[model samples]
Target: MKVDAISNDTAYYFLRQLGLERFNVKNLNAGHCAKARSWESKKAKGAWSMSRYAEPDENGEVEGVDGQNNNVAYLSRSNGNSPTEQLKKIGLSANKFTFLRMMRGSTLRALVPYLNKEQLLLAMRLFPKMLLVRLIGSLPKDMLLKMILHTIPLKKFLALFKAKVLFSIVANKRLNVREMVNGLEHLPREELQRLMTNITGSDTTQLNKPELLGMFRELDKLQLMNGLRKMGQEHFLEFVYQVTKKDPQLLMALPRGELMKVVNSMPKPTLVELFNLLPKSQLEQFVSMLPYKALLVALYQIDNKTMESLLVNQFPDLIAALAGDGLEAA
Candidate 1:
C-alpha cells in the first residue's frame, strides 16, 4: 500500500485534473512534513481530531463543536439530524470526485472511515489495483490496517501485502532478504517470474557481486542485520564485504555482539577499508558501539602497515607522539 511507485508529479497532475489548478508539489510535501510534526506533538498530549470537510474561515479557523455560536444554519440545511445523515450528505455532495482523487487530498482522507460498505465497494470497483494501493497508503496506519482487514478479501489482501513488500525492497525501505523471500511466495507465478527478470535481467544470468551490492544498497541497517543474521560464516564475511563496499552504514544496524562477531570474522584488509570509508563521527560511533576487548583484539590482529595508516588517518597527534614529536610540534 506504500505508494512510493507513484511520484509526486503524478499526484500533482491528478490534482490539477481534479480542479486544484494551483496545486504545488513542493508545498504539499513541505506542508505534510509540518503537519506530521504538529500531529506528533498533539499525539503526545493525547488530543487530536480530524474532520473530512470542515470549512475554515478567512482566519483559517473552524468553530469548536461546543461553541455557542455554532453554524446552525449550515447544519439545518445539510438535511438529516443524525451524524450518518450529515456524512451521507457530504459523500453525495462530493460524488463527482473519485476515491483516488479524494485520497490524494489531506482533507478528504478523513472521509474514508465514514464510507458505507456499498460505497466502499463502488470506490474499489472504480479504482485499479495500483490506485487502490495509493488509497491504502494514504490512510492513517491504524485506519488502513483495520479497513484492509475488514474490506479486502483474503487472496487480494495477501497480493497487496506482497506488493507492499516488493515496493519496500526496491525503494529506500530496503526490507531484509527473509521478508522479501517470504513475500515472494504470495505473488502469482507470472508476477514472480517478472520480478526475477526485473531483479537480474531479461537474459537471466546470475547476479554478479556488484549487481548484488547494488540491490543491497537499497536495504537499511535493520534489514542488513536481518539478512546477515541468517548467513553462514564465510558467506557472512563475503556479504558484509559486498555490503560495506556499497555502504558501511548498513552494518550499523547490527547489535553490538553481532557487529563484534562480524568484525572478528572479517579480513584485515576489508576491516581497514571499512574504517577508511566511515566518516570521523560514524567511526567514533562504530567504536563506541563495540566492546573495548573486541576492539583490542581487532587492533592486535591488524598488520603494522595497516595499523600505521589507520593511526595516521584517525589520530595524527597520537602518531606524532609515537614518533617523539612534542605536543606543540608536528
Candidate 2:
C-alpha cells in the first residue's frame, strides 16, 4: 500500500492540488476514502499515518503526505485543524504548494519568463540533480534504487549540480582563469604566485593553443598584464609570446599609454635600438617621448622630410623635450 505504488494519475492530481490555494477537498472522488482506510490499516498499531490529521508523535511533530488518499484521510480525521494547517504539516508552505499544484495543471513554460537570469541559472543547475534523484528513487522494488543509493551519496549529486553550473559559465566564455585570478587578488602574495603558476602551467599544457589564447585575451581585457609583467621576465615573455603568436593584431592595437610604459621600462640602449626599428607609423607615435635634443641630434643625421615634418609641425613631444632644456643648450 505504498503511496508510490498507486498509479492513478487522477489520484496524484487530486493530492498535488491540496497545495493550491483555491483547491477544495470536497471535489475529490468519494472512492478514495476506502483506499485511504486500506492504507491506514497496513500500518503497525502505533505507526504514524501518512495523513498528519492524527495526533503527533512523542516529539509533538506531525507528518503528512500529498495525494488524494492522504488528503481524504486528513479531511475525515481532522481534530479541527484547517486545510492550511494540514498542508503545513507536510512540509509545504501554502503559497508554494499552490504554485506547484497550478504548474501540474497549466504549463510550466509560463512561469519561466518570470525567472531572472540568476534564478534561471540556479534552476538549470539544480533541476538535473532533482530529476536524477527522482529517477533513482522511483526504480521498482527490483533493488536497483537500493544499490544505486548505496553507491551515490546525495552530496555527490549536489556537487555534480555545482560542477554543471561552473561548466556552463566557463563554456559560454563568460568566465575564465584571468577573471578567477583577479578575484583572488586580496589573497596573500605567496598564494597569488602559487595560483598563477599552477594556472599557467596547467592551462598551457591542458588547453589547446586557441583556448589558451582566449584565456589570455580575457586576462588582457581585465588589465592583468601588469600583474603578469610583475611576475618576472620569464613569465612575462612567455605570456607575451603566447599572446603575440596568437594575435599579432592585438600588439598593434595596444593602448598608447600601456605601450609607452612597456617601451620606457626597457634598458635605455635596447629602447633606443627598438625605437629605431619601428615602422614610420609606430615611430611617429613616440615623437612625444623622444628627447628634443636627441631628436635634433638625430634630425641633423636624417636626410628625410619625415623627420623635419614631424619635428617642425607635430612636435609637442619635441617642444616639451626642447622646452625642458634651456634654449642655450638647444
Candidate 3:
C-alpha cells in the first residue's frame, strides 16, 4: 500500500493522531514501498561514493577503533558497537566528527548515485533551507536552474523557494530576483503559479500590466533613493505619484532603511497614506529601526493618545521622551 499522502512527518503525525494508524515515508504501507536502505544498496559505479562517509582530519588527530579512547569507550558502552561496526563494514577509516564533516561538504550531484531509493525520497529533508535559498539566489541563472531541475524532494525545494522569508530576503537584495526567476521557470506550471502567488498575492494568470508596472516602478524608486543616479525632489514626487496609482505593497521590495528614507522624504499626506498601507506588525518592526528624525516626523502624524498608547503598550523607553519636553531631556 504505497501511500502518497503520508509521505512526510507532518502527514504521518496528523493521520496517526486522528486514527490509531502509524505511518512513515519509507513504509506508509508495509511491503508496498520498494525503497531500500543505503547499506543494502549496491556500491556506486563512480569513484565518488555516498556510502563511503570518511575524510582524513587536517589536524592529524587519530581516533582508535578500540574501546580505549574516551569517545570510542562511550560509544561502545552506551550506543553499543553499531556505529563503529557499521564503519568497519563499509571500510571507512575516520572518526565520527570527520565523517560528519565529509557529509557537510557532500554535494547532491556527487552523492545522489550512492543513495538508495529510500534515501533519495527523504534527501530533501536534510537541506539547510535558509542557507541554501540565499546561495541559490546568488547563483547565475543558468546554474540555479540546472540545480532546481535535478534537485530531490521537489516539495521542500518548492516550499523553501516560495516561502515569505525567502521573499523578504530577496527584497532586501540578499537574493537576486533574476536568478530566482530563472530557477522558478524550471518548476512545473502549478509550482510556478504558487511561487508567483506567494510573491505577488495574486494568481499568476491575473498578473497583468498593473503588477509588473508596480514592481518595476518601485524598483526604479529604490534605485533613485540609493542607486548611482539620484533624482531630485520634484522627479521623486512624480515617480511616487505613479507608484501611488498602483499598490503600495510592491514598494516593500525596498530595503528597510531605504523604505524609511522614502517615507521621510515623501510629502506629509503621502507619508501618512503610505504607512496606512503597511501591515501593523511590519510597520512596528520598521518603526523600531527608524532614526530619531524619521521617528519624530512620524509622531506628528498620529494623535497624542495613539502615541501614548504606543509608548505604554510597546515602546516603554520612548515614554520618557514622550512625557518630557524633548528627546534630549530623556
- lDDT per residue for candidate 2 within 1-330, as digits (tens), equals 122211234433433422221333332223333333333343324343423324323432222222232433443444445444433342221122221221111122222333333323222222223332332233333233223223444333223322322222223334345543433433444444443454455424344444444554555433443344345433333333343334333233333333233333334333233223223433333332222212211212222233233323332222221122221110
For TM-score, candidate 1 versus 2, the one ahead is: 2
Rank candidates by TM-score, best first: 2, 1, 3
Each model's TM-score, in the order given? 0.18, 0.18, 0.17
lDDT of 2: 0.31
The residue pairs in collision within model 1 are none
lDDT of 1 by residue, 1-330 (tens): 111212345435444423343433453343333332332344235442333123333432221111112334223433324323333332311211111211212222222333333323322322333433443344344333343334434333334322223223223343345443433333334443343454434642455544544554565555544443443343333333343334433423333332233234434333333333323443333332222212221122223344334333332222221122111110
Candidate 1 regions off by >4 Å? 1-140, 157-174, 185-198, 201-330
Error of 3 at 185 (Å): 26
Report backbone clashes per prediction: 0, 1, 0
Worst-scoring 10-residue span by lDDT in model 1: 321-330
Worst 10 residues of 2 by lDDT: 321-330
**Once superposed on the true structure, which residue ranges of model 3 sit more than 4 Å away at CA?**
1-111, 116-118, 142-330
Which prediction has more favorable lDDT, 2 or 3? 2
- Candidate 1 TM-score, true structure as reference: 0.18
